[model samples]
Target: MTDAVDRAPAHVAASAVLRVGGRELDLARRFAVMAIVNRTPDSFYDRGRTDALDAAVRAGAAAFEAGADLVDVGGVKFAPGPPVPVDEEIERVVPVVRELAPLGPVSVDTFHPEVAVAAIDAGASVVNDTTGIHDPRMADVVADSDAAIVVAHSLAAPRTQLPLPHYDDVVGEVAAFLRERVALAEEHGIPRERIVVDPGHDLNKNTLQTLELTRRLDELGDLGLPLLVALSNKDFVGESLGRDRDDRVAGSLAAAVYCALHGARIVRVHNVRESVDALRMVEAILGWRQPVRLRHNLRPEGNG
Candidate 1:
């Protein structure tokens, strides 16, 4: 098998500008925190906590106040369960998107092209497709709108169970899949600046595969686009640490740090405050950001 580094393309600078909903984000200088706001009753993490429109809106506002750079509102859970009709999905996300648009950049998590269109109409600037463009029309919908698109690598349809995932090389395969999807988006008229890619941590992967992907995440940067990683209390971390969903904060933060150091420019997380702090610390360490109000360590010249 070829080494991961050898298989990766030549390193290119991470995308500098990402335009969504008329707002431009400078990815080179700062990391983005995408807070998850699930409107589905059966979401794995929240589990109906924000299923109501009002509750979802409140959660979005709180996430923004907690320092999230973006909020991703999803109408359906990714796990298999009851099917959500297009109208129901639109109803679930459109209102929340409309209410949250003024707060910051809003992204709608869905694979349905019609839902994507409605969410964009309601002020969402990005479509977070977990199926990696399962619907052929999704790319066209995004291309016709001003919204950006997140092309996540998933081997199966959303909400379907992958009993066992077998990969010759997880990271390499994921990168190739995303590269193809990115080209598909561009071919549909969605410019490079309006696209992002995700490795879909735990979506169709087991624990070991996810860890390998995390360790070799930089290889995805060779695609020459900003990387978005969803590492918020995921099953991979939980299974690795023998912890439950609520107890995976520390592990999640550690994974987030690793991803950010490697090349991930955006992190989708459930804990906004901690993720914000962790990413900022990583950026400061990398010299991409500065310390806030530094004064505690300064020594007086006369005393010295």
Candidate 2:
């Protein structure tokens, strides 16, 4: 079986691109980057953006300008915590969603059904719910629109204080969960063309689980939807690199690029420029017809 590079002259990627609203994301080849612009004060990353809407807007603009095809704007963190109310969640995210939705393809990163409805009603083109359609109303909220839904497989709600959960087969379970939710979305009048799958990397995963997921990416590809991989600065990277969140830019870029090269179609990231650059290099390498020659192999074309 020949890979994408071997079938060059423009091989169509296994990935599919869907138009959320006015903007169109390039999901062909390796998945394009969807940079995160967290609009929350307590998010694991970019916490300050929530305190000021202007900063959040600026960050969104920068993410787009830097090469993110879509800016994922979310006000809440999926960490272990209490459930946030609908009104408060709306208050935290709406302004940024409104401001950034016009710039490009804007996706609201939320799990609340009301939040999803309001965000799309405002200007967001895609509803990126991390709950895998666990909320009863989430499926119906965007049932009629062209807006896309991401069925992210998170083990439990963000606030659940369960002991470190163990999955005998994490990838299999995640794929099953996402597939089930996709069915649920279809039942609620959502089109198959508008569904994407996300294996919730940090929601309930440890370092080993996350790393294993990356290695076993093909396990989730069977769902036959665009795969969005968010590998920004989570605790795994911190532990691996012995660096704090702020210092995980390099690590995040590495993971994002690695995932894309391996078949991920939508890389949700933070350092948009760095991730784009890394993927470009990977594409050039895997995409090349032949390897580059060193200077020592300086035979003339005729002499060879």
Candidate 3:
């Protein structure tokens, strides 16, 4: 059997650009940033607030102007803990979607099918499913709406408690899993051009597993779809650098920078300001995002 992990992802199977309102997410461009808009308290990134819709609106707009080509809004906040009810998720995210989708190309990060439908009705253009479409109804929602989807590979639960860490080869397992799900989505009527893959960083796998995935991140590009990296300031980033959650800004930017170099296109981070500046520097040095794809050496010659 050809292990999907051993194989490399060429491009995310996305052939067409995701047109959100007036913004065109041209995936052919090297990479882009999708600012995190958490309208819930329990998000793993611990971002924006659900109660304060107006403030959250401001945050979304600011992210758009701050070099964010897309804004991802999450109402249910999936972390390593209990899941919120579908009704609560809808109530929290729908209003934000209704308000922000008009403002920009907004994506809703959710797992519940009901929540997905509500978000779509509220004008969300994308559905980011971290579960890899475990719920059958999830595909139905996406199929009915015909929205762009992000199918990330996850295990155990959205929050972190697990039976135990288990993977023969961590990176290989994740890549294979995502590939299978991508196929599964196709089976369920979702076209290849509308999907993106994410190697779930902190949702299911342990710190070591995440590091392995990051080390071989380019492997995902073989899928031939535009890649999206949610390399925000998470617990694993802290574990690696011996830093705490509050101090993972540099680590988050470092992880995102690494992902970008490895062919991932969209980086999801909490500290948008820092991530933006770092990617700008990346564009300046690497020239990947430049008009000519600059090809400058971010590192000096012979540094290796």
Clash pairs, candidate 1, are none
How many backbone clashes does every candidate have? 0, 1, 19
Whole-model Cα lDDT of every candidate shown, in order: 0.89, 0.77, 0.75
Best by lDDT: 1
lDDT (tens digit, per residue) of candidate 1 on 1-304: 2343233233234567898979998887578999999998888898899999999999999999999999999998887776889999999999999999999999999999999999999999999999999887999999999999999999987778888999999998998899889889999999999998899998899999999999999888788898899989999999999999889999999999888778888999999999999988866665665689666879865786
Better of 1 and 2 by TM-score: 1
In terms of lDDT, model 1 sits at 0.89
Clashes of 1: 0
- Candidate 2 residue-wise lDDT, 1-304, digit = tens: 1475675323233446666765555566444778888877788777665457888888889888887788888887777776778898898788888988778888998888888888998898889988788786888887866688888888676557446868898888888888888899989998766778888776678888888887787667678787888778888888889999899988887777666756677878877888877766666666642335545757767776
Candidate 1 C-alpha error for residue 72, in Å:
0.3
Q: What is candidate 2's CA lDDT for residue 95? A: 88
C-alpha-based local distance difference test score of model 3: 0.75
By summed lDDT, the worst window of 10 consecutive residues in model 3 runs over 1-10
Candidate 2: residue 82 lDDT (0-100): 68
Where model 1 places Cα greater than 4 Å from the true spot, the runs are 1-14, 299-304
